[model samples]
Target: MKINPAHLGFDIDGVVADTGGAFIRIACEEYGISSLTLEDITSFDVVDCLDMDQGIIEAIFGRLLDDPLDAGLQPMQDAVSVLHSLAAKAPLTFVTARPHEEPIARWLEHFLQPDTFKSIRLIAMGVHDRKTSYIKNLGLKYFVDDRLQTCRKLAEAGITPLVYNQPWNKNGHDLPTVNNWQDIQALCAE
Candidate 1:
């Protein structure tokens, strides 16, 4: 089914940004933990899935949360181009669980064209749960997120949630999904 651009919203971390990949990279490069891979991130909470030190996990995530730009957090494949296309149709909306908006905002600004960045309505709500109200407030009928729990919550709240395909959320969901930005683009009606 095709959705209007104006009624669609996105999540940042796993959906738009390659947060898991960055975490793996940082673990391999700086922390000298070379055994990690994206597939091994079977859980959204990295500490739960990987047999790594909790302190190290916290430090890596802290770095990403504090300065995603500096953490070398890259956009998911084809996300930038698709976002630009959608932005031309309507102002882009991103609702993230990150606590502070400035860091991820800066990261987005770095990747998106200045005009696209200006057209974005980003909300860093700081909590993973209870995003239904914020999304409803934005008049979004559909939201794409990688966290199954959040998607489930949205679904229960009477919103259509597109589960952004990720290893961490690959199971325990029966919702419609978008595998990549190309799939996301197809979901948009021309």
Candidate 2:
């Protein structure tokens, strides 16, 4: 089966890049505290648990002013191959909550070739819950994201949400989940 979507939406953090570790590390550094493991930061809120100021949070993680790609960020296993396969079939759009676009473009450039990601479009900034609106506006046939809330919102808005399975989202067994990009490729192919 060959399923070609008009547009596909993607989440940036756990979906593409291994940012959880970096976020926690930066948070610890900003607060002048001991290095935090991923487990320590997983259940804790970025603002409260890390004791980080808004400005520092924005500068390090929220805002992508700096070239995060150059910061040695790595793609999730087989992410590049899956994306390349998907792009070969249909348009791929990165729908992230990251406030800055340039850094994302740079980060994507690190993993994907210039031509493969040239058509990739960035959605509105600071629009986390409004992902359904973006999908509706863009006429995306399907969206792949790591957030269960976002996936629910997308489903409520009449879009097929492909939930990217992550350890953080494992508590509930209700949501539809896919293990990795390979599963997404298979889903898209169906």
Model 1 over residues 20-53: C-alpha lDDT tens digits?
9999999999999998889999999887899999
How many clashes in each candidate? 0, 0
Show where candidate 1 strays beyond 4 Å: none
TM-score to true structure, per model: 0.98, 0.78
lDDT of 2 by residue, 130-153 (tens): 778877888886787777778888
RMSD of each: 0.7, 3.3
**Residue range with the least summed lDDT across 10 consecutive positions in model 1:** 124-133
Candidate whose lDDT is highest: 1
Task: Score candidate 1 by lDDT.
Answer: 0.94
